[model samples]
Target chain A: MNESNSPRLDRQDLGKIALVSLRAARMIMESGGRAQVIAKSAQTVACGLGAEFLGLRIGYASLAISLGDDANMITRMVVVGRHGVNHRLDQAVRRVVQRITTERMTPGEVEVELDRIAQTTPKHPPLFVAAATGLACAGFGRLLGVDWLAFVPILLASTLGQHARHYLLGKQMNPCVAAAMVAFGCALISSQGAKLAGSDTVNLAMIASCLLLVPGVPATNAQTDIMDGHPTMGSARAVSVLMIMIFATAGIWLAGAILGVHP
Target chain B: MIEAVEHLAHQAFFGGVAAAGFGILFNFGTRDLLWCFAAGAIALGLRTLGLDAGWSLEAASFVAAACLSVCVAGFLHPRLDPAPDMIALTGCIPMVPGAFLAQAILGLFALTSPNPDKEITTVVLSVEYLLRVAFTICAIGTGLAVPLHILKLMNFRGSAAE
Candidate 1:
């Protein structure tokens, strides 16, 4: 849309547009979208709002973007909270930008639409997530050449750990703390598999059960961000992932120390 | 030869199932989950095949990750563009070095023992395990990024930098 021909949205409208767009970009970043995609979506909104200049600075846990015209400039900073990779939400935000440009929706309409997207509920409940955790780890155990005997323990321990983690997260517990606690429980349960008289590698079951807690997305994005010239943000995320790994292992070690399981 | 393919298929299926778990946790839609599963299965199966063919662990891991990035960016990106990274990121979850990480920490517990012999064994073993963990983690990062870097070089903005 031509700037001269476009319907003139008020300053208030532009402000609302910027805020909504910032929230959307923050949502994307916190949901595991990389720096490139985050910039693309935010730029879409800024330009859509008829901004003549866009300046974006992405950080470890926050992002700042300034959108301005010849006379008016609005810069907004968004704090990126805990990341939970939800592709569906990320797609919703992207689709919103596409809709704004194609439909020329007013900022009010855009805000309402974003609010609707935010209100959309998760399709899977916590119970389903817990069960999927068990299933995922069982699949891991199988790939590791764990037989059915050991697989049973992996499945059970993972399910138990997933439930505990789910409950803790629901209570707004720190993720690393939840991870450590869940790993302890998982290891304790899996140690029973070690006691079972079998030739199976019992340690495999214990380790596999904790696979669900590994921060795979963070690790991947950290590398991408660093390679893409966002070293500070990327390394921060990398350190976070490394810390989560250590916390998870510490939990397992604590379990072993208490349970007396050699493996 | 047929047996190898069949075994590969089986391994991939497990990898898919494992990746699907992450798909679930990540709140990927059902369609995205299926695609993520396939990409993960293929990448992991390829890595295992390379291992069976006598490739080094790091080499196999890096190759698998590169394949995963390619599959996600090239094949899945167009279909799932706006959110391309989601599929590959979750798919690689199963391949993270969970076992080696745990062993590295477990090995650290050996530090408390008073016996000098036990401490020496612990130090050597822990170092070896931590080194492997470091390599595997590096393998995952480099593996996944290299393909994306190539695409960026080619100016293919399907998923990233578009």
Candidate 2:
């Protein structure tokens, strides 16, 4: 519909639109959308729902949005839940945004869509994830100079570490602490296995096995956000990556000391 | 020549495996995982070729990632629904300096021990490894970002004209 044929939405209607838009924005942000994408999506959704303006502020931990002109605007802020990658949710939100832009979606419908997206669960089971982690770290070990003899140790160590991490995270453990523990356990196990195999690449095995603990998503996202002009969010992600690295290193060091394998 | 090709092929295969694994961890679906595998394989293959040509590690990584990003944006983005960044960035995982970062952190931790005189070499090695990690990461980031920036600009222009 063109401008004249567009129905005039009152402040209340705009408020609902704003809430739904904010919900979409929060979902995208929490699901690892970059700041620019989040802002653009919120604006697109709000405008599609008949709001003239959307004032969006995206932070690492929260999102705030305003609807309507100066005096008549309704603003809302929501603290985002745990930030992590959820590709299905990301794709779902993108679909909702696309729908809103192309087809006329009521605020209620948008909310329902957002709710479904929010309820999205992990795509792969824990066992599958663990198996993938094993294969991945083994590949990484080969790339990092681990000999074929040490590959089995890296695979088993990473698989067990991933399981340990999955269990700890399910128990509502702090992600950093869980990562540290997993790293320590994987390093200890891999080092011992390497020794048993008489492989000289024990240190390489230890390093490659715990690589599943590296914060690859956040580290990459940090750089993207920083380079894309979202300094605040970028810095937050960068700091989190640094902390994980430190904690994982501490775990590796402790394991090495116990195993008498100093690299 | 055949032995060299075999070596590169082996690395590429492992790179794809690693990328697929990371794709699952990052919550990607099956199709996206396949794309990740391809991206990883291409990236590692290119980097391996570069290294064989005597390029520095950081330079080779930057070039490989940049080539991957450009290919993603120029050829793949329109056909694919998922963001190009996801595929390209995940592909870069096989190149991460996890070992260097770990060694650097370990060296720093070792410096706090009672042997000040023994720590000079450790400090130097730590600094070296830390610098390598930082430079490598920066190279990867820049390589990824440059193409994305160009793509975004093209998109902006296209949208503005509409």
For candidate 2, the chain B TM-score comes to 0.89
After the best TM-score superposition of candidate 2, give how far the Cα of residue B125 lies from its true spot, in angstroms.
1.6
Report the poorest 10 consecutive residues by lDDT, candidate 2 chain A.
A1-10
DockQ value for model 2: 0.65
lDDT (Cα, tens digit) per residue for candidate 2, span B1-162: 999999999989999999999889888888789999999999899999999999998999999989988988767875455466778888998887878999999999999978655778989999999998888888888888888777662222223224
Q: State candidate 2's TM-score.
A: 0.93
TM-score of 1: 0.89
Provide the fnat value for model 1, as a fraction from 0 to 1.
0.78
Residues A175-214 of candidate 2: C-alpha lDDT, one tens digit per residue: 8898789999999999999889989899989999989988
Q: What's the C-alpha lDDT at position B56 in model 2?
A: 90
lDDT tens digits, residue span B42-156, model 1 = 7789888888899987788888888888877777677865555566667677777677767777777667667545777888888888888778777888887777667762222
- Top TM-score hit: 2
Query: Which residue pairs collide, candidate 1?
Result: none
Model 2: lDDT of residue B63:
96
